[model samples]
Target chain A: MSLEERFNEIVREYSERVYWHVRRFVNCHEDADDLVQEVFLKIWRALPSFREESGLYTWVYRIATNEALNYLRREKLRSALHFGSVDEEMLRRIDNDPYFNGDAAERALSKAVVRLPEKQRQVFILRYYDEMPYEEMAKVLDTSVGALKASYHIAQEKVRAFLSKVD
Target chain B: MVRKNDISTPQGYFDELKGRLGDIPHRDRRGVRIFAPWMAIAASMLLAVLIGNFILRKTAAPVEEDNGWDYISYLAQSLDPDGLPDEEFLTDVEQ
Candidate 1:
């Protein structure tokens, strides 16, 4: 099949999955929507260079994960510059987000996850929310499985601790 | 239960996003990158030929078929003989 057909197939198959994965990182619809498009744009641009070294799903995940992390880092810097606070600003964005309709517990979970450092937050979301296997997570995060498990453990503890305090 | 994917988007957001994205103009960057340098080289060669023609026309052969001093004579006629270009300039002006 032609590249356009392949791209269309890939978009049909994975766009929703990519969107939800991105949403977990941002906890907002508009940002996740924007990022979903960005991820596909990267995929389309990089498709020719794709050597099939990794599974297509994992390859897409790697691109999406990097984009999300880079976006979060930028947002943190922007928030700090704008509001004198990253944590508070993210919390406010999460809480006031029009797309977020989570109840108290889900809101608490989001807040707790947001409090974790970048890697820990990522590992936690992939492990706890997405239930992605450690091997797959390793592929996406470019870390050893042992390291990802360890990071997930640390993230779980921190998130649980935060949830306990907030609850 | 803290259900993941609790976030909501505008209705039909997923259904429409693909068409919307595909609608945005995209080019095959790989194809572009592969062919861009050759296009530049061909374009530059064509440009050089054009400019070379222009410069050659601007500084064409100065000698006539018969007299062999068409341009120098023209300049000689155009200006005072005392103010005519120096001999070396005239020599260089020969085709």
Candidate 2:
């Protein structure tokens, strides 16, 4: 297949995956949608130089993670500069959002996941929700497999403890 | 007896999420396509200008003196020997 065909296939396959991955990081659907497009646009621009050293999924995941993290950091800085107040009611509304698929326990788990450090949150989401293998995760994160495994383990333990406390 | 809770979400939860996150707007895509090439060209030109400026600056830089002795000699010879650089010479050699 030609490169454009391959690229289109990738977009069709992973656009939703990328959307959900980003949505988990930022709770807002609108923001997630924006970042998803940005991520794919970046992927399209970067595809010319993409050597197939890593799997395509890993490359896409890497782009999604970077876009999400950078978006969070930028929002954090903007909030800090603007002295924005946390919308606790809005957050509660998000918890009760009709589109959220989780049960009560799962919702609580997601809330706790949001509270985690950025790296831990990324590790947890990729491992649990994405069900990605450690090898692929390591390629996406550019970390050693051992480190990714350790990170996932620690994140799992943290989530368990947080959920247990919530219960 | 264990109780089974078959809690099914509303029929369209996932579908709602999908709809809310539809494709990027067509106008935005048009803007991207139109401006993307120009952006690339502008970036390349800017890079070229920066590189040319750097090369010019490097080539136009003043040459350094090889040693302090050559500079010192130039300074000493330019000044009058009688007015400076040797009271002893003036006393002995008759200024």
Candidate 3:
């Protein structure tokens, strides 16, 4: 198959999955839409250089995760520059998002997830939302499985604490 | 822990997104990371030049308002320089 054909197949397979992955990270459909485009563009560019060191799914998801994390980092910096809180801004977006159909409990859960530190947030999302295996996540995140477990533990506790207060 | 997705997109969003994304290899064959910045810079420079030209033209003195040199420059540009008056004649005229 031609490289373009392979790329198209990859896009058809992963675009929606990656879109949801990034959408959950940003909690805003507009930003998620833009980021998904960027993610696919990156994938297309890097497709030629793929070394096959990791499974294709793992590799594709790693790119998506990294792009989402970088986006959040930029948002945090932007909020800091404007003297606003990134967590609050994200919570606001989630609350106001037209695409978000979550119930009150789900909304609260999402806000709690957003409040976690970046690494913890990513870990929680991958585990809770994505149901991704630790081994696969480790490859995607380049973190040890033990560390991911610990991070997820800490993240779960934080979420539970936040939910308790809300309830 | 319950795991369920609470987010939703408009109908046919993914199909549309996939169509847009599938063209990346053809549309952005050169890679966005490279071309986007350079395109932005080139665009900015072009805009700046255009704006600068516009402003300069707007603020510039009109060509009809000769500062006493246009006549001399015009004379110098004549193909038949021999027919034009010499430095002594111009100095006499200026005085």
Candidate 4:
């Protein structure tokens, strides 16, 4: 297939998946939408030199995940500078999120997920929300499966405890 | 089972999204285009001005003003040493 066709196919295949991935981190529909576009824009730009060293799906996830992580860090720094707690700020965004259609329990679960440390958040979200296998996640995260499992286990415990109390 | 996602987009967002992404030209991936001819012209003009300034400095004599060192030397040469006040006499008058 021509390059444009290939790029379009990628967008068609991964956009929703990438969108939800970003949405989990950002907690705001608008921010997630913007970030999803940014992730694809980055992939499109870097498409030429994509050496195919990893699977295309893994590569796309890596780009989307990195965008989400970077966006989170920027938001955290901004929130901290503005005299707000990052967790509170993110939860506020989630509270105001128009696209979220979850029940109270799901909302509580999402809050619990957001409260995890950044790397653990990634591990938890990918494993629990996307149902991504650790082997595939390792390719996207550039982490060993063992480390991912440990992080997810810790994250899972934290979420479970938070849910038990809240839900 | 992983819970169903809470987030939802407007219907057919993915369809419109692909089209929007396609509109973005691949040139964006490449660095911005620098105007090479304009840069070359600017470099040449700068070089020309520098060379012209250097040549002017080398070829043109510096303009002398009143009370300049050359003028003072000329004035001292024109004077008779005998007609000038002695250093000892001048020092004594100052005291």
Candidate 5:
């Protein structure tokens, strides 16, 4: 197959998965859309020499994770400089968005997840929402299976604690 | 007392979350622009290999130079003495 054909096929297969990965980090659809596109763009450019040393899905996940983390970091800095606080108001607007399907409890859970340190949040999302196995997650995260399992357990505890407080 | 209405939040919350996520525009392939640096590096490597092969093939022909007998004798001496040519005596050859 031609390079472009292979590239297009990959984009078709993984775009939504990439979007959800970014959305779990950003918790906003529009931002997730933008970040997912950026992830694919990076993948396309890097694909020519992407030695198939790892599964293609894992490679894409790695790119999505990095892009999401960088987006969050940049957003945090931008908000800190421009608005003095991360814009809770804007996030609340997203909460009020008609398309948001999560109930109050789910939203509360999501907010708690968002409050987590970046790595912990990523661990939680990949384990819970994506339903990924610890081994596969280790490949994408470049962490050992033991470490990922520990991180997921800790993240679960944090989420449970936060939710129990709301209860 | 399990009540149907006992759920804390409004009934539509999950539906809304799912709808929002679902409504997110699928990223179009045409929208993504590949990074340029990777292509540039690949192109340069290809060009270098091609140029290197061309230069190597061009220079493949052996060249001969005129050197005194002593130089030849030294080269011969570097070989095993048993294999030395009888045509030249090592000592007689001018340094």
Candidate 6:
């Protein structure tokens, strides 16, 4: 296929998925929108070098996940520079987001998820939200499956504890 | 249970996003065209001309005022270091 045709196919297939992945990290629609575009731009630039050794879905998820992590890191640094908490900032974003129409419990769950340590949060989101298998999560995260399982376990406990307190 | 996503975008958002992303390759190619070989060559020639003009200006001999005294002095110095010419030379000039 022509490069443009191939890229369009990728966009159609992965845009929404990437957007939601980013949205979970950022807890804001506008930020997710910008990050999603950046993810696709990187994909477009790197497509010529893609060997497809890993399946396209795994490669794409890897890119999306890395971009989301980078964005969160930057956001954390920015909030630290301003003497604010990144988790608090994310919670506020979740509360104020116009696109988030979750019920109160769902909103609380989001808040709980965001409050987890960064690695745990990533594991939690991939396992719980995406329902991604541990093997695939390992490929996407570059972590061993055992490590991913451990992180997800810790993340799940944290989310459960937070939800119980709020309830 | 918390749904994985309760957030939704406006209708047609993904379609629009696809269109936007699909244009990236063409947009990037258009940017690449600006640096095509012809443009690069033209830019190089322009830069060479500019550098050449600058060097010429910097190293050029300054234009001197053409007042006639210097020419007269030059002629006098070449013919005779003393202001007066020899009588024989003067006679030759007259002849």
Best by TM-score: 6
Model 3 clashing-pair count: 0
Per TM-score, what order, best first? 6, 3, 4, 1, 2, 5
Model 5 regions more than 4 Å off: A87-94, B1-95
Candidate 4: which stretches are off by over 4 Å?
A: B1-4, B26-95
Docking class of 1: acceptable
lDDT of 4 by residue, A105-155 (tens): 888888998889888999998998889999999998998999999999999
Off by over 4 Å in 3: B1-4, B30-95
Q: What is the TM-score of each candidate's chain B when compared with the real chain B?
A: 0.34, 0.36, 0.35, 0.37, 0.30, 0.37
Candidate 4 docking classification? acceptable
lDDT string, candidate 6, A1-167, tens digits: 97667888899888888888878899887888889988998999989888878888888988998999999899889999999988899999889988887799999999998999888988888888777889999999888999998988888889899999998
What DockQ values do the models have? 0.24, 0.03, 0.35, 0.35, 0.02, 0.31
What is the C-alpha lDDT profile of model 5 across A1-167, one tens digit per residue? Answer: 87667776776677656766677777666677678667877886788889887899899999999998898778779888887545473457447655467678877877778767788988998888788889999999999999998998999999899899989
lDDT of 5: 0.72
The window of 10 residues in a row where model 5 chain B has the poorest summed lDDT is B1-10
Worst 10 residues of 3 chain A by lDDT: A15-24
Q: Write the per-residue lDDT of candidate 6 for residues B16-79, one digit (tens) a residue.
A: 8778887888887786887798889999999999999999988999888799998898787767
TM-score of each: 0.72, 0.63, 0.74, 0.74, 0.62, 0.77
Q: For residue A40, give model 2's deviation from the true position in Å.
A: 0.9
Q: For residues A25-76, could you state the per-residue lDDT of candidate 3 as single tens digits?
A: 9998889999999999899889899886778989998999999999998999
Q: What DockQ class does candidate 2 belong to?
A: incorrect
lDDT of 1 by residue, B1-95 (tens): 22355577788887899886674335444556879899999999999999999999889877646765887877776577566546634654483
Error of 5 at A100 (Å): 0.8
Q: Which one is best on lDDT?
A: 3
Cα displacement (Å) at residue B23, model 6:
1.3
Task: Provide the RMSD of all predictions against the true structure, rounded to 1 decimal.
Answer: 9.4, 10.8, 9.6, 6.8, 12.8, 7.4
